[model samples]
Target: MFKGDLTVAAAYLTPAGGAVVTSVSPVGLADRAANEVSFTTSLGFPKKLERILHNPRVSLAYHTREHGFATHSHYVLAQGRAAVDLQPSAQRLAELMDASELFLGRTKRGGVWDWLLREYHQNRVFVDVHPDRIAVWPDLSASGPATVTGAPWPRHPAEQEPPKNGTTPRVPVAKLARQIAALPHRLLAYQGADGHPVILPVTVTGHDETGLRLAASSELLPPGGRRAGFLAHGFQPQCVGVSMRTVTGWLTVEDGRALYAPHTSTGMTAPPNRLVTTVANGLLAKQGLRRAQRNGTTARLHDLAARHRAQGSERQPTAFEDAPAQSTRPQR
Candidate 1:
């Protein structure tokens, strides 16, 4: 839990209702005090904040081994409810300084820098999720059964009927397959019975009319068919130069094999220039804030002040304290 710098995080949504989105998320572990895990997002990113406010049920998948994050840990999945703080107190932002700088280099606050990044750094939201279920696989392959700690696992919902008028991958198979091959890293997400999303590592075997052929062990997959999100992403050292492609659609698992029918696809590519990246981030944040204003998300706030109020009297756990020590499954 402590070692990771970033995770591929999921927030649930639907098509008619919307769609679930997953992204590169960095949860500041050093700032997590008193037995809770959390990640911070810019108030500028209105869509993500709105979704979390709508459905607090979310998940974080910690599998990064490169760029110096989560290197010692096996693939871990944490599913739980998220409590959001849209209007943060100065005290909360003050508490986040150390961990924030540790993952993302030091904050450069000055004349032009302060004015440029005002909304991005100052106007932000924090989300805390206390895991109801934490599952671990031996490694990123996710080839065998996971050692889990939480409430009893739900029965496989195999008999439940699939959604009517299921969606298909709108993008051409050949085009996306090439892109997927270039970006080898992959993650798959689907909502659990409790509505919290579950994401695990997967491999792309090939592609056809059924969408991308996803390969992973049967134990890791949710049985039968359902709507799901797929992410193919890669990053260079020090989190420089990155690319990602996200797909949302139907996921069908049978005979120990799975197929992902992508309904929609979106992506971004960035070069290895830090200055350019920083500039782009500021611009995007400003635009996102405006979008939120237009959509009225800025007006609705779900305040989570319980933790901040108790900060003075509570004792925060050290990095290794929260995760359970026992492993129910054999490690390689």
Candidate 2:
């Protein structure tokens, strides 16, 4: 849709009760992630449009090359509402003018036509279409199609396949752990308690979603401090059968070697209890832990610790409390 150019041939039932032939240029392509596209056009006969479109009803159509020897005409009709927008920042207008020459391959000289051309940019209007009806058909003839049908298009064979046998292999956890441990100082940056920047030694730990379960040590986490450390781990790229979000696996680390085994019986539980409980309930179902018994533990611990944190001990409160605080704080 972003690659082709369409010419605006005419407008009907407009304010002046006449037709205008002008062109509308495509401005931008859709951001695939967000699903949106934008464009700009000129109403060549402004007086005629303003007069006829007291209740505007307009249709737009374009022809584009499709598969070999076939072409398609796309049509959309918008009625009742059309808007005219004339606000553009100086930077925006300059960029638009510059882009116009690059795209259209022409520039205007002195005269009323030049003035009109510049006004087309400076006063360029917007027609927002909220179409009540839309129809698209693959047409081979420029004369347009006489009938439309809703039928499944033909599909090529060899596009179908059966599921493969056996599970996919992952990048060994040992390699991942080594990468984290030997992670270069070039990428390390941190800030101190006073908001001044500092660099700290990196401590690597293998974690699967719920939390990082590094050995309880004074070096990794100081004895008097909270047992908290950052963890970074993701699904091995070659693990074809597993998705990072849904995979149930163990991150085995021993003697500086690590391995990720999918469809295993191991469960990762991060501390302070509640987060670990939730992750265990969701992903660790295959393990023998009973749901009712686990829920009892999580609720009891939460009730016991909720009031304790209110007394202002510990570096941070539980995750459930942290979420509400983040939401209530207004953005700057």
- Highest-scoring model, TM-score: 1
TM-score of each: 0.84, 0.30
lDDT by residue (tens digit), candidate 1, 148-267? 766545655442355566556667877878876877578887766656676778888888876888887677687777777888887765455778888777788878788888777888
Each prediction's Cα RMSD?
A: 5.6, 31.2
Residue 304 in model 2: lDDT: 37
Candidate achieving the largest lDDT: 1
What does candidate 2's lDDT look like per residue over 210-237, in tens digits? 3233432121122211111122222211
lDDT of 1: 0.66
Mark the regions of model 1 whose C-alpha exceeds 4 Å error after superposition.
Answer: 11-21, 30-33, 69-71, 159-164, 301-322, 325-332
